[model samples]
Target: MSRGFTLLELLITILVIGALMVWAVPSYSSVSEKIKMERLAKELSGFVLMAKSEAVMRRERLWIHIVMSGATNSSGDWSLELTDRDTQGVGNRLLHLSGKPFDGITLSNTYTSDQISFDETHGRPKSGRISFHPINASTDLLEMRTYHRSAIVRVCSPNSALYLNYERC
Candidate 1:
């Protein structure tokens, strides 16, 4: 004579739902972290491309400089800064790009130089490669040597490539 679920049936349903949530919570957190890292990597790659393009379009020297926050010689957050070659052809201009904290994403150590430029003649990176490692949720360090996944942008002349996985960077 019951139109709806009995007490036992309702309790069983709640238990099953609770079990699923418990199982899914960890997986969902992991997926979200991966997505945030991936997105931040893509954005960094785009920034490099934009600088290269701008250099050629403006017929001038445009460069990108990476600065690491330091406290008593201890490195912290890494910030990307833009610099333009001055009238004397020196990279003395500084401009900070503004953006929100991109989903707690952080950059890892992959780039070798603190500053890099694009050749105005070829619209290519002057030299060297830049890398972005997604900080592990487990480890807060910017260096991902201990982490497995990352993203890279390589400036290898005509062979230059972007959107590369960190392992290959």
Candidate 2:
């Protein structure tokens, strides 16, 4: 005959809710970070592909530049720029992770040159290959750590294939 829960019942409910939140918050954050990383990677890769297509279609050279710099207002956010090799006009661009530096995230060693250029024939750089490695230089993979993010854009020779890897700090 009680319209409201007793004090003990209310306390038990509150404790259960708090425990669930404690267990779920971290997992949710991790998942969200993963999604952001994956999305950034995909977008970067797509831009590379588009650049390749443009080169072949226009019968001219094209280049995509990756700049690892601090976020918009922050001091360590990573960003990228894509330009036409001929006109050098802005084609595609992105600033990583929306300027939100996740805790414990940092970019390790990066092995790419300042710019990646594609020829009119949609071929990879005839001069040499650019490799990105973690700061340790033990691997070609870039490590994204707290307050930082790392990105890797790899284009196959002849520009027939392209791959991108992005990680959140």
Candidate 3:
């Protein structure tokens, strides 16, 4: 008799592998989406901190413009551009991060007023004294939904306080 596996054993092995994949694929995808969302949030926070520091050091009006555009199918690109405008009335002395979107993520809410422009001297934009969310009196939500995946980043501004709420959608 052959020492190798019989036909029956081979079929069973294939079926077991298929079953394992059916259970693992969805979980893996979910985890991946979560990781992407977290990474984007961290990047945004870092950029904000960097802009603030630069403004303070240079003593100039450094602006961090957060722009989001595109749809879920188009792989939307949102970027943070840092520009320094001095008292001389010059516009955009420096261009930082020219609108780069996160990997595996498409941006939505283009008209959702998600732009958060902040200057070192003025702190945040005209919306309120705080940057992020929960500062503006409007009920407008700055929500960033991940691509084909199931994840969302809801930004709310209340009482000049910015809050980011991350949840699986």
lDDT of each: 0.51, 0.45, 0.46
Q: How well does each candidate superpose onto the true structure, as a TM-score?
A: 0.58, 0.56, 0.57
Query: Model 1, poorest ten-residue lDDT window?
Result: 142-151
- Write down the worst ten-residue block by lDDT for model 2: 142-151
**For candidate 1, lDDT tens digit of each residue in 56-145?**
788877777766543111223455666785222345654553324443454433434556666666555644443333345433222222
lDDT (tens digit, per residue) of candidate 2 on 1-169: 7598899999999999999999999888666655544443445456655655666777776665645553111233554455664232355442222323322233322324545566776434323232222222223232221110112334322222322333322
Prediction 3 TM-score vs. true: 0.57
CA lDDT for candidate 2: 0.45
**Model number with the top lDDT:** 1
- The best candidate in terms of TM-score: 1
Ranking by TM-score, best first?
Answer: 1, 3, 2
Error of 3 at 56 (Å): 1.0
- List the candidates ranked by lDDT, beginning with the highest: 1, 3, 2
Candidate 2 local Cα displacement, residue 77, angstroms: 2.8
Q: What is the lDDT of residue 36 in candidate 2?
A: 43
Misplaced by over 4 Å in model 2 are 70-76, 85-113, 125-169
Which 10-residue window in model 3 sums to the lowest lDDT? Answer: 128-137
Task: Give me the runs in candidate 1 sitting further than 4 Å from their true place.
Answer: 67-79, 85-101, 109-113, 126-129, 137-169
**C-alpha RMSD (angstroms) for model 1:** 8.1
Prediction 1 global C-alpha lDDT: 0.51
Question: Model 3 over residues 37-146: C-alpha lDDT tens digits?
Answer: 45555665556556556665666656545454433322435565676643222476455543334444543433223333444453433232112211221332234322
